[model samples]
Target: MMDVLIETRGLTRNYGEICALKPLDLRVNNGEWLSIMGHSGSGKSTLLNLLGGLDRPSDGFIRVGGEDLRVLSEDGMARYRREFVGIIFQQHHLIPYLTAVENIMMAQYFHSVPDEAEARTALERVGLGHRLKNRPGELSGGEQQRVCIARAIINSPRLLLGDEPTGNLDHGSTRVVMELLSELRAEEQFTIIMVTHNHEVAAWGDRTIYLDDGVMVREELKGD
Candidate 1:
């Protein structure tokens, strides 16, 4: 059995005539945090999507927590997406009508039976207990993003995948969110792969990878 939590070999992705990603090799150990940085159309998002199972790779081996995503069926992949990978989109995709807790509850419904108690606890974990009753429109941007994060982790996923989670926030809020992400990652012991263009945000990860033209060009490990 491989000790690596995530390992991809010769991963390739394409969209029509456009080559979204080239054959790439990447590895992430258990409980490690990895960040991918690149400019727009550089295949950063494509790599994250493939890792999270939102998009299938044209060619590659994708292993997450012992499961080979490349071989999973559609239903199996959906289950993996719900139970194994937690995703944080750049846009806080909370329902407009649902309150913070309700939004999390909806996520629960998709993955399994809704557990209000667990949903509430997830919101509280993100320091949004006070705003649980407030809808996304009523809460601040940071708070909404926190709710999104809470929803993402409600299932206790083994891998937390994020795509520019703090891209829309201010510096202070970005710091707060990044700090919260770092804290939760340490406490939950989950592997994290975040894609971002911000250097500061990438600095929060254990390793930073630079992608250009669908290829990984640079990587470095940071000491705490």
Candidate 2:
């Protein structure tokens, strides 16, 4: 049986007079790596935000792991984000002063209790064991992204969302980040939904969906 991890029906989002996402249906299976691709203002990030609980849809239904997102209260949504979703952004939103491990521990603090040892292990899994004490300012672009990945996965979320996570990286760094994500996904068995404009980045996913003007225009399977 196919384990559907995420599903949306007639999902829509609006900003006053502007509709950011049109009524659309989507389904993602457990442990699937799904990539969203589009030009700016095409509603890729808007869809991601709706899925991650960062933003609510204007109308329609979204369900993840059997929970309906539209009915969740603010606190309920917060809890859902903490327990079910992990997100990475292009900006690497780490505190400038905190060390890599400290940043990871901070995420744990929000999800439950902070454990330094577990945080250390998370960083180590991303091949950053030697750079635990380095702050974001001290790390290279790729290393900083690795720290972000470590932090995102620290809470053991069921769904991982990335918004142009490799947008700021060079080719080498991008490859490293994607490879690390692939390895971690295999081990952790979490579903991934990533938004990216880069074709190379989108190609790494098992499937890709293209959005244009808030509508899903087309989709491609891995080899198609």
Candidate 3:
């Protein structure tokens, strides 16, 4: 039996009078790779933010691993994010002043105790063992992104959320990053929900869902 890791009912989000996301009902199975595709204002990021507990839904409930997000306080949501969701943003939000290893250790610091050994292991897992002392400015786009990936997964989050993670990479770098993510997922068995505008990138997932004007317009399984 497939375990449903994430489920949403009547999920909606609004900013002022603008509805960023229409009522959505989504179910994500454990260990599934789900891709979201949309145009500029299609609420793709909004959905991801909600799922990561970075933003609260205006209405409805999000249940992940049996915990109801709607009922969580701000601190509770923070704890939820630290314990369950790992987000990789398009910008590779690493502190420019910090070295690759330190950027990862920052995540560990926020989670609880910061362990240099574990941080080093995570960076090495992302193939950055030799670049640990390098700062973001010293790293290439792909290397910086690898640092971001290492930081995201340092806490061992159950769900990995990627918001245009490969948006800034070249073809070769994109392939490397995607393959790294796939390898990590295979070993970790975490669910992944990635938002991308490129169909080729979206095709990497097990299934794809397209959104338009805050509504889910289509969904396609990989083999279909």
| Per-model C-alpha RMSD | 1.6, 0.7, 0.8
Q: Where is the poorest 10-residue window by lDDT in model 2? A: 140-149
Q: Model 3: how far is 149 from its true place, Å?
A: 0.3
What total of clashing residue pairs does each candidate reach?
A: 0, 0, 0
Query: What TM-score does candidate 2 get on C-alpha atoms?
Result: 0.98
TM-score of each: 0.96, 0.98, 0.98
Q: lDDT value for candidate 2?
A: 0.96
Q: Pick the candidate with the highest lDDT.
A: 2
Give lDDT tens digits, candidate 3, residues 1-224. 99999999899999999999999999999999999999999999999999999999999889988889999999999999999999998999999999999999898998999999999999999999999999999999999999999999999999999999999999999999999999999999999999998888899999999999999999999988
Select the stronger candidate by lDDT from 2 and 3: 2
Q: Predicted candidate 1: what Cα RMSD to the true structure?
A: 1.6
CA deviation > 4 Å runs, candidate 3: none
